[model samples]
Target: MKNFLVHSLLLAVLLTNSCGSSKINKTSNPAVPAAQENVSNQAIVPAADQLKAYLPLLKGKKVGLMGNQTSVVGPNNEHLVDVLLREKVDLKFGFAPEHGFRGDIERGEKVSNDVDAKTGLPLFTLYGGNAKQDSIVKSIDVMIFDLQDVGARFYTYITSLHRVMELCAKHNKELIVLDRPNPCGDQVDGPVRKDDKFKSNVSFHKIAMVHGLTVGELAKMINGEKWLENGKECKLTVVPVQNYTHSSIYKLPVIPSPSLPNHLSVRLYAALCLFEGTDISVGRGTDWPFQVVGYTNPVYGDFTFTPGEKAGMVKHVEGKGAVNYGLDLRNINPDEFKFTLKYVLYFYDKMPDKSKFFARPEFFDKLAGTDELRKQILAGKTEKEIRESWQPELAAYKQMRKKYLLYPDFE
Candidate 1:
C-alpha cells in the first residue's frame, strides 16, 4: 500500500510539472474562476460580505465598492455586485485592488481603468493610488470593502483597504467593511514591521506578517489604534463573520490573487514569499505559480518545470518560459502550516554559490517589513534565533490586536 501511494504521488508530481494540468474543477456551468470554488459550503457559516448580511447597511446609500471576484452572495455563488445592482442598491462606481475586479491579472501587472461589461459601471484601479480618488469619493456617500485576505500584512489587499479607508476618512464618508474569513486563521506568527520607513505597497502598517484578523477586524484595529492620519478614525461599520472563531479553517471561495491559486499556496505564501527578493522564481510563468519555488537553472534541485501557456492559467511574472529546478511541493497539507523560515534557510544553504542567491535587498526588505530579517539571514542566523528576535514585537502586537477582535479567538 505504501509503494502504491508513493508511485501515485510521483505520478501526480510528474503531471503537475508536465504543464499538462488545467484549473481545478469549475464552480459554474461555463467556467467560474478557480478561486471562486469553495471547499464544501457546509464547513463554513455565512461570510459577512454576503449581500444578505450587508444589504440593509447599503440600502439608500450611494455605494462605491472596493471589492474583487471574491465578493459573492448565497449558495448560488452569484456575485454581490450583480445582486446589488439588481436590487436597486444605487452602486455609483467600482474600485479594484491588486488583481483587478475580475481577479485575473498577474501579480504586479498593471490593471487599467475599464467598464464592467456586465453592469456597465465604471471601474477604477485601486492597486496603487487611483488618480481620480478625490472625485470618486465625492460622488459616493458610502464605500464597501469586501475581499478575502490571506491574513498576511503584505498581501496588498489589506494595504489597498488601508489606502481606501484613509481616503474615506479624509472625505468624511462612511465606509462599511464586509468581513470575510482569514484562511490562515488565528495564526499570528512572524515579526512586526518595526517602523514606517519600511512601508510599501506590500507593508503599509506595522502589523505582524501573519496577522490573525479578518479584514473587518483589522479595519477596527486600524481605526482603534489611530493608525490613520491625525488620529482620526474613518466612520466605519464592520459586519462580523458568523460561526467563525480565530481558529476556523476557511477554504477560500475565490483565488485571492492570480498566483495564490489554492490553500497550500496561500499558506506557503507568507513564509516563502521572502524569496521574492532573491534570484529564485516563485514558480511564476508556470502552472504552479505559488505552490513551489525554484531557481532558473537545472542544477538547483531535483525537479524541473517548463512553463507554457494554458488558457486562463496565470504564468509567473519573473521566470516566464524559464525551466526552473527545485523541490516539488504539491503534496503539502495546508492544515499543518505555520509562519516558517526553514524552507528559505534550507534552499539558500544548499545553493552552490551564495553570492548569486539574492538579487535586490530593497524588494526583500519591503516584503519582510524589516531590514533585520535580511541582515539576520545574511549573517548566518539560524531559524530559531531569527524567530526568537521576533518575540518582543509579536507580544506587543498580540496585545494591540486583542482590542479589536470580533469573533471568538484561538487564544
Candidate 2:
C-alpha cells in the first residue's frame, strides 16, 4: 500500500509535467508551460527511472556506471548511484567525465581518479584521458552510461560517451545507455564536422554542432556507422525515454553541469559556446554563465559586468577582474533563438582589431569542427552565405541521421 501510494503520486506529477502531443511549436518556449502545468495524458519517463527494464540485465553481473551529478532517476530526482546501491545491483565503480562525479569540479580542471566519498566506490577519471581505461573496462561485466547531455557537440559528456563506447567495443563488453530527453533536441542546425584531421574530444563524431539525437540514438549511430576502431561494435542496449519524441519539450529536473544553471542558459549554449574560441567572455564567473557574452571593451555593449573567481563553478575565469561589455540575453524569448553564427559574426565586425577577435583561432576551429567558419568570418561572409555553404553537408547529415532516430523527429 505504501509503495502503491508513492508510485501513484509520482505518476500524477509526471503526467502533469508532460506534453503528450508530438507537435513542433517553434514559436514559443515549451519549457514555460511544461514547468507550470502537468496536464499531459502521459509521463515522460527517463530510462533510469524505469528500473525494472534494466535491473534484470544487471542481475548477478558486475556493473560500472559512466555517470555524474545529472545521472538521476525519479520525480524526486534521486541519484542513480544511490538507487543502484539500494537495489544491490553489484555496482563496481564509477567513471566521471569532464566535471567530477558530483559535478563540483570546474571546467578544464584535471579530474583525478578518486573514491566517491558518500558511496565509497572507486571512480576512474575519463576527462583528461586516463591511462587505466583499458583495465577499468576489463573489471566490469557491463557498463551503464547515464549522463545528461544538452544536445550540443562540445559538451564533452558525449565525447566521454564515445570513449566509453570505444573501450567497451575494444573489450567486447555489453554497454547500456539509460536515455534522457535532450532539452535542445528539437533544434538541429549548424555546421557538420569535417574529417578526422579536425576531430578532437569535443567534436568526436562527424555530426552537426547541434546534433538532434538522444545519447541512445547517438550510441546506435556510433555502432551502426562502425565509427569504432577496427569497425567493432559494442553489444549495445538503449533503455529509451518513455513518451518522448525529438520535439518533446522536456525540462531537465537537474542542472546538467555547473555552468548551465537553468533552461535559459541551456537554450543559449550552442549559440554562445562558439565564443569560447574568441576573446569574448560568455559570462563565466558571473551569476548567469552562458546567458550573456561580453568583452573588455565599451564598444561591445553598455551593460557591464566584471568576472571573478568562483570556486567550484568557474576557475581560470575568462575576462576575470575586468569590465566586459556585450549582449545580455537572459530575458530573450527562447522561441526566437536558433543555432546561428550571427552573434559571433556581429562581435567580429564590432571588434576594433579583427585579428584579436579570434584569440585562439585554432581552438575555435576545433569547436567548429572545421577551420572554414573562421576563414569565412575573416573574409567578411554574411550569415546567410555561411549557412548556405553548410546546406550540402547538412542535408547529407540529416539523411544519415534518419537511420539512427528512435523517436518522432521535430520536422
Tens-digit lDDT track of model 2 for 1-411: 223112111100000000011111111223222322323447898889999989988999999888877777788777787788899999887888876776767877877777766667787777767778789879989888888889998888888888787777777778888888888999888899977778887788899999998888788778777777777777787777777877777778877777888888888899999988987898888898888888898998888888886645556578999999989888887655668787898899999989888888888998899999999999999999999999999999989888777676788
Candidate 1 per-residue lDDT over residues 303-398, each given as its tens digit: 888655543355445556777788787888887878889878877887788876678789888988999988888789999999999999999999
Total clashing pairs for each candidate: 6, 2
Best by TM-score: 2
Instruction: Give per-model TM-scores.
Output: 0.86, 0.89
Question: Could you list the CA RMSD of all candidates, in the order they appear?
Answer: 11.3, 8.4
Query: Against the unseen true structure, what C-alpha lDDT does each candidate score?
Result: 0.71, 0.77
Scored by Cα lDDT, where does model 1 land? 0.71
Give the distance in Å from residue 147's predicted Cα in candidate 1 to where it truly belongs.
0.9
User: What is candidate 2's TM-score against the reference?
Assistant: 0.89
